[model samples]
Target: MKKFDKERLLLAVAGPVIALVAAMVLTSVVLVASGKSPVEPYSLMFQQATYSDVQVLIINEAGMYYLAALAVAVGFRMNLFNIGVDGQYRLAAMVTAVVGAHMSLPAGLQIPLLIVVAMLTGAFWAGIAGVLKTTRGVSEVVSTIMLNAIATSVIAYLTLDDKFGVPVGNNNTTGVMHESGWFPGIDMGDSGEIYGFVVVAALAGVLYWLILNRTRFGFDLRATGASQSAAAASGVNAKRMMLTAMLVSGAVAGLAGMPILLGDVHTYSLSFPTGLGFTGIGIALLGRNSPVGIALASLLWAFLVKASQALDYEGYDKEIAVIMQGLIVIAVVVSYEGVRRWGLRRQQQRVGEELAAAARAAGDENNGNNDSVKEVAAR
Candidate 1:
């Protein structure tokens, strides 16, 4: 059992490492094919990533990615694809920004209240898809894609009027949140300010780990994901688990935009960052839906995003960065599956050897028992 566990751990760790190496090699080939020096791009990327200001930016960006990926991972563990995280976070952020703008409470109360409202709004929006899935057999993918459009339209309509938005220069946006509602930034000497909600993202990762690995509900969720029919036979309520997963996913998605909204922009505007939720899907896949893996993947993804900016100055197409990211995700998913199959084969071989050895020992004991009985009878 100990050996088996060690092998499992080794495989888990090695899978990602192998995947990354494979991805780098493939990306280099692509770069060479395009007549670019792979070494130059990678060197530039790493050099820029090492700068203090760039490091802070990477962390801040990674924080948001981490939260977004966590949101997607929750649904993934339950076999759900929550593509609506984009819509959920955007709508939640807009509503929270609007609410925060109207309130003038102390920072302690206002921030939490804003966050709660965001979570509730996101939950409600995602719950619609879950409810439809359970009650009307609607596919979450189709429903979520439709929900994204609906969310965009809703935001468009709401922000066009003075009721939910105010004109700021040429753009429409929610009123700026009061200082009391803003999260303070962290100073890093010469590195300017890092978004304080990085801590929140860390806490979310810890909580996700605990809930998915250390709770009974998590067991039911994993079981259902493994085999819904088996989980049902074991008395797990598939519908209830699905609903809970979706709600939790959306609630986390609510936080995906909070760091940028509360820590920097302090408003939800037409210029707010979008499509991060979709990016989360790729990050989650690259991480294999694990917390630690997701954090690392988020950082790597953020680094690439930051590093890509330097390409414009270096006379290289920035689109190559996107291609690398896409290739990494695809390569990682395939490599992980390959590693899983290899691990399964090794485990099966070990089990077979153990069973064979046990059978031989049993046969020897039976022969010894017969010889003893015959000797006793002769005496």
Candidate 2:
């Protein structure tokens, strides 16, 4: 249709498609080098992932990944890389677990309180980086990476034997939360109960889209991302938007763990999931930071995760999935750049063609006028 629409297609559709293709090709090569048939392993992965239990697991895991992707997307839209989401989420979950364990609030109130505590804890942790970036000119990337290390130490200190830690077998945990704080899930019969928090994650996605695509603050966030100086010239207060974006991202990151905390584990323990924040970065990139895109990306990620385990049982290395994931992440970056350059080239070609057509039309008009003038001179 329009040139702008064409360029957007390259971004929203073409990039992911190209990335998937490239990742698959590279993964196949890896399998071939290992003296294995690439097709068989993939076929097995897909077939095994079709089982009912695995499907349930994929959906449940996708819920968590979707939340994390949304969190990363928030910062992504503002050109902020909040690498400390790992720390932010861990600290938030730990602190929220402690609160949920100790508090004895009424029904509904306890869950809300714990969720609030999580969001606030995540925000506070991320805010330290925000404050450093805006006030002291420290790079968020450096500060956030450092924050993750600091968060681990802080969690360790808080969970010390003589402190809030409750020894559960070989590991320490922030004792199980009261039943009042537990979120209910939908029963899937033999498959398993799908995390109730999945519904919340979906709602969060909708809210994210609305905020980014339908609000002025979103416009400011995007503007700042595109060009901080330009946004500043337009009176958008770029620094404030940057800080706000980081805090919002952290707030969302806190929710990434709730599906496990409230729906399954009901506590913060050494077994709590980690590296999810890093995973979210890849999902966000693969999804191109769109709400729908992120959802699909999370599903694909979860599918690979569930299917990869099946590989181990089949005498195949489960690390194949990890290699694919790594390649996909790398391909996403390359594909985006490639598509962007292609779009630019296409746009230039279109402009050149239009200008050439206009020039030809002008030449025809001039020739016709000249002929008419010669006729008059002849007469």
Candidate 3:
């Protein structure tokens, strides 16, 4: 394979493998410290993984998680840390639920409309931060973080009031969406199985990949991401790119919440978000900010979550999963940076070698020409 391809392959494999090894070592140390065998908990987790229902649950949850991770990954590529994805997602879900609950459109129109409105809501919410950063000279990091708090407050207010409140008492939640807005599940028959949101997740992964790899817009976004000053100098419009990237990221995140709102809960509630946006950062890092990588990372996370839930039946603490996740994230972060630096060093060395070789070739050609001149003079 070409050097570039090899470098990509190395990057693709290094982080997750290193993370797995590190997580294993950490789990072993934890078990030893706790005076328990690591083997038992892992064995139980493995056992749970074999169940059909558990597998379905993992796939479903992973699909949702993948959407969130993709959203975060987009911002990461632009060197923008979008910490307010949770709020963007929540606001979108709220808007979707409210629209779905009140709209009298047919099923075909209502579902699509709800999805579009949700995406727009998320985009608008994120645009606020972008505008603040571009127009007011605020740091996107600070603005996004503050926006998350603001979104939470707004959602709380909307869901707590009787006119806007869901029937779920004083809790902050919107009323259930109408049947027209619900996503349809596929029946697998006999096996008591249903294909859930995995299809949406797969499509999302493809969409993200295409957007990044094939589009002119994506090229401009990546250019700005790599170097905002350079991009601006080249007439790429850096501020607009940043704002567009954030809006697109928010839209993706908004779609991420739809699985929970339309499929799992059938409504928007205070509990709708459930920290998936925060978890997405870990997933994005673990996946190395690639679409396929993020999808696989999400699947791995979903597996751990499902395995953790089974701990209740096996008489083990569910917190073990969280600890394992933390360990994995740390491992991936360290390894990714290490590998990236190593790759850069290697590239620099190769470039230096190529330049030296060219210089030597030029010197040899000059020497040969000198010899020819000397011989001709002697003749």
Reference-based lDDT, each prediction? 0.91, 0.92, 0.84
What is the lDDT ranking, best to worst?
2, 1, 3
Off by over 4 Å in 3: 169-172, 189-196
User: Which digits, one per residue and each the tens of the lDDT, describe model 3 over residues 1-379?
Assistant: 9988988788679878989888988977897798877778888888988887787778778888898898899998888899888888888888889888888688889878988998899899999988887788788789888888998888778877666786565456677788888887655554233435567868888988898889988888888999999998989998889899899989888888887677767777756656888889999989888887888889899999988887777767778888999999899888888888988898899899999999999999999999999999999
> By TM-score, is 2 or 3 better?
2
Worst 10 residues of 1 by lDDT: 14-23
What TM-score does candidate 3 reach?
Answer: 0.93
- Give a tens-digit lDDT track for model 1, residues 298-359: 99999989888998899787777788788887877888889889988998999999999999
Give the candidate number with the greatest TM-score: 1
- What's the TM-score of each model vs. the native? 0.96, 0.95, 0.93
Where is model 1 more than 4 Å wrong at Cα? 377-379
Per-residue lDDT tens digits for candidate 2, residues 1-379, read: 9867866765679999999999999999999999988898899989978898898999999998999888888888999999988999999999989998999898579988988999999899989999999999999899999999999999999998798999989999999999999999999999899999999999999999998989999899999999999999999998899899999999999989999998999989899999889999999999999999999999999998888897878878989999999999999999999888988888799899999999999999999999999999999
Among residues 3 or more apart in sequence or in different chains, the pairs in candidate 1 whose N, CA or C atoms overlap within 3 Å are none
Better TM-score candidate (1, 3): 1
Q: List clashing residue pairs in candidate 3.
A: none
Candidate 1 vs. true structure, TM-score: 0.96
Name the lDDT of candidate 1: 0.91
